[model samples]
Target: MKSVQKIMPDMRHFEPLPDMDDRQFQQWNALLESRTGSTLPLERKTFLVTNLGMRMREIGCRSYDEYFSMLEGMEGLREWNILVDRITVHETRFFRHPMSLDLVKEYVDSKPHDVDTGKISMQVWSVACSTGEEAYSLAMVVDQAFKKRGDESYFGVTATDISPASLNTGRKGIYSERRIKEMDASLRKEYFTPLSQGEYEINEYLRKRICFARMNVLDIDKEPVGKMDIIYCQNLLIYFERSSRHDIVKNMARHLLPGGLLILGSGELLNLDCPELEKINNLRVLAYRRVKEPNKDQN
Candidate 1:
């Protein structure tokens, strides 16, 4: 038989947050979907609620209903940014997926050598590039590949993300040691300068080649990023609905140069049927290429 004291639950650690009801959950789901193309399912509402509770406490909202009302208009738009920063996941590192980088290298090796004919060099875009790691990773790879080919021009990388905070970290090009320990040692030495404070700042050669921007996926259609040779948008679309995922990919494809590559996170979208995208299945690698430029008059 269990002891009476053990059987009785301790009253001390049972503090619970205000319960989020169905209507309130729906309101949050809709607002999130409209702003970020992401929907939190019913089962995931607890996670959403926890994050909301933190922000509500910071802003002194007593209830979830009060929080919902505060998330309303022009002023609410500013709050939305803070909310997004809290709720959205931004986990990334240098060469997060090595296989993807390898495939990109193969593609770069296949490109015609730069013959000083004043032809446009390669243009790579690291979409949703959190904290500049991916953008700098691309630069390092491209720089080494171009050098091995006896080519000297270091192509630029355009990195974009929805979180201004993430973009700000990326623009600084400084990273902690723990953040980069998994990176190749040789590459780390070659591309970064160690600081007295024990942080490593990306070398000027790689740093100057990247341009960071804050962009929401919904507004991508309006931006003229024009004709990228490689557009790497990985580990991002999983947060959105399947229909929205397809739309984002289609929009991204519009900016690809004819026959240029568009690489997504593995298994991100299966059986993708975009008319302009031709899926490439190569040696356990999944990627797509623009079949041809969309006609000027057609979207």
Candidate 2:
């Protein structure tokens, strides 16, 4: 179970928040969809009720309707951010999905040497990277591939999420020993510094290669991030309506440079018909490759 962080009210006493009715649930679901492009299905009513009840208690709001009313207009924006942070899933670890990471490593390893710079220059984006594990995992694989080839490649990762709290944790680049236990001993030793406690901090070399930012997927197209060689967006679109998922994927496809890779959680979407991309045929992975840039000399 995902733990909900508490934001306690200053008051000494308060009544219990009222249970959310069907109408109230609809109202809350619609608001979430409008703001974040994520929808809460009926089965998640208990999850919604639990998280909302805690937030309501923090503000001493008694009724769901009253709390819903408070979330109106610009005044409610800050509270929404807090609510989003509490509700979004952040259960991830280093190399959580080995198959996806393997595909990423394979792609990087196959790249031919750059003719001009004599090194591969790669840009990667980790969409909805909660607490930085996925972003850092990507950096590890890319960096290792470059080292294996004995080349000084230029690579950077941009990690984005909507939750400020999660981004803050990611920026610190610190993790408990349990969080990194599954990582290979050699990689862990090479990339992390032992801290005072059992926690470890990512080495400066890898930390400096990633940039973490706050972004709402609904506003993805407006963000100024340029093209990327790899865009990893896993475990995100499952919360969105099907149409919204398609729209989001289409916009992400636009961010991919020619021959760039787009990886998603297996079964997140099937038959994504993007004219600029072709589906990668792997039963163990969900990925697509944008059409390779044409060779000028051949023309």
Highest TM-score against the true fold, candidate: 2
Most accurate candidate by lDDT: 2
Global Cα lDDT for candidate 2: 0.89
TM-score of 2: 0.91
Among all windows of 10 consecutive residues in model 1, the one with the lowest summed lDDT is 8-17
Query: By summed lDDT, which 10 consecutive residues of candidate 2 come out lowest?
Result: 290-299
What's the C-alpha lDDT at position 47 in model 1? 86
- The local lDDT score (0 to 100) that residue 159 gets in candidate 2 is 99
For model 1, the stretches where C-alpha displacement exceeds 4 angstroms are 1-16, 113-120, 293-299
How good is model 1 by TM-score? 0.88
Write down the TM-score of every candidate.
Answer: 0.88, 0.91
RMSDs, each prediction?
Answer: 7.2, 5.8
